[model samples]
Target: MFTNDTPRQGLLGRFVAGLARTRQGLAGQIGRLFGANVPSAEDLEALEEALIAADFGPALAQQLMTPLHQRLSRRDLSNLDQVEAALKRGILDILSGVAPPPSTMDHQTRPQVLLFLGINGSGKTTTIGKLASRLITEGGRVVLAGADTFRAAAIEQLGLWGQRVGADVICHQAGADPSAVVFDAVQAACSRGASHLLIDTAGRLHTKRNLMEELKKIQRVVSRQMPDAPHERIMVLDATSGLNALVQARHFHEAVGLTGLILTKLDGTAKGGVVVAIADQLKLPITFVGLGEGVDDLQPFVPETFTDALFARS
Candidate 1:
């Protein structure tokens, strides 16, 4: 479990670096809009447009600006720093309101199941590999379950990650029943005394009905195999996809009740505000965020640094 233990100072630097694109754009907008003696209606409207353009979504963009609006109404913009501070505080509030409580189990329970869900190419497999590598480095035992039986390549890719990370990979022949793979994986994790079991589920979202049902089946199988398992149902999203990511989250959340979120490619998008939109709309905790291609780039989500990173100056 990341447990956001990457150290605050280090995490802040990583977040600032990962959010470079977003910080440049958002910070520039805030500075330019509020640089004047007092913010004009036009400036406020432009700020809203910038927030929406950053993929905060129209409603959240408006909702998040309430603090800034309050300052404007109260003629409290005398302290220029307060302008950006209010925006940061607003975003922080949205993120913090949905933050999940810290994991108390702390990998004490053997074979804690984690279900990875997303559409094809959402970096689900890669994220799993990175997570396994981290857990193993921290001296935790991990088992990778290639539950995506539809693709022979996915099974092979997960196997490679397992090998590289020195974790066990449980997979059936390509085109086998995914649920069967999940069941066997659970058994293997227990028998091997692994601390965590990461299951890579099918991502064929084009067939919504078939894919969702298969995922539900896998969830049911895992639940019966190990009680109170699938402890984490994490949906991986491409940050570049912005609001579209929310659509996928809604689908999976409604289908099997996602417990957390993982946004990938954070370093590649200027629209990181989508993070706030998803958290506010779904009310789910974001466990980890993929900042870059490196394994360590997949760091735990620290809300304070993440919010600060959005407006960090060069």
Candidate 2:
């Protein structure tokens, strides 16, 4: 867990840096919309364009400015700082209620299963490895299950992460039953009394019929082994994908309930405002955000800093 007391550097530092970049990108757009003496309507339009450009989605972007427009219309238009403050408040309101990650995620139980599900190229496997490393650093034993039997490299990649993190990995040859792999992994974790078990499933397009069915089967098998296993079902989203990320979130929710979101590749895209769009539309809390490629790049989502990073002056 990232606390406000962590001094805001390194992993948190890079995250703050990324937020600054995103805010700069957004602010540049808003600044361009108006000149020396801006009218109230012009400021409102400028703010809307700024947010939309940041990937807040048009509907949400406009909704955010509703109150801001009212204030701007009546407030002293002589102060640009006032405009900035109103814009910040509007953006903050949309995300103020973004829920925090579950308090029960302290991983007190042995073999706490986390099912990592996402389409290919969404960085699911890498995220799992990083999470495992984090758990280990926090004094938890981790076991990884390579249930992504569809791709040979997928299993290999997970094994490599296991080796790097010094966690046990369970995987069969390619094309084996994904469910069996998970079943065996759970049994092993139970026997070894591992603190956590992170399962890596095959990354399939949401459109794949057979692949999705296989994923469900894996979930059922885990439940049968341990009725309360897979305590967390995390859906990884590629932040660079824009609104299509929303489509993937909905599809995955329909396929299997998502407890929260793990947004990856945020450092690679300035469209981080998609986070707001997702929260407004899905109401699924974003538990983590990946700012870079390092093993420690992941950070728990912080709404205040996130708002400042997007709309606050750099």
Error of 1 at 181 (Å): 0.9
Candidate number of the best lDDT: 1
TM-score of each: 0.94, 0.91
What TM-score would you give candidate 1 relative to the actual structure? 0.94
Instruction: State the lDDT of candidate 1 residue by residue for 76-128, as single tens digits.
Output: 76655666678778888889876665563265568889999999889999999
Off by over 4 Å in 1: 104-108
User: Among these predicted structures, which one has the highest TM-score?
Assistant: 1
lDDT of each: 0.86, 0.79
Query: What RMSD, rounded to one decimal, does every model reach?
Result: 1.7, 2.4
Q: List the residue pairs that clash in candidate 2.
A: 9-13
lDDT of 2 by residue, 1-314 (tens): 22332344443456667666566767687766545565568767877787788788999988887866776667656556666676667656666666564363665566788898888989899999888887788777889999988888989999999999888999999989889999999999999989888899887735567767887898899899888878888899999897889998898888888878889998888788898999889887788788877787777777766766555443
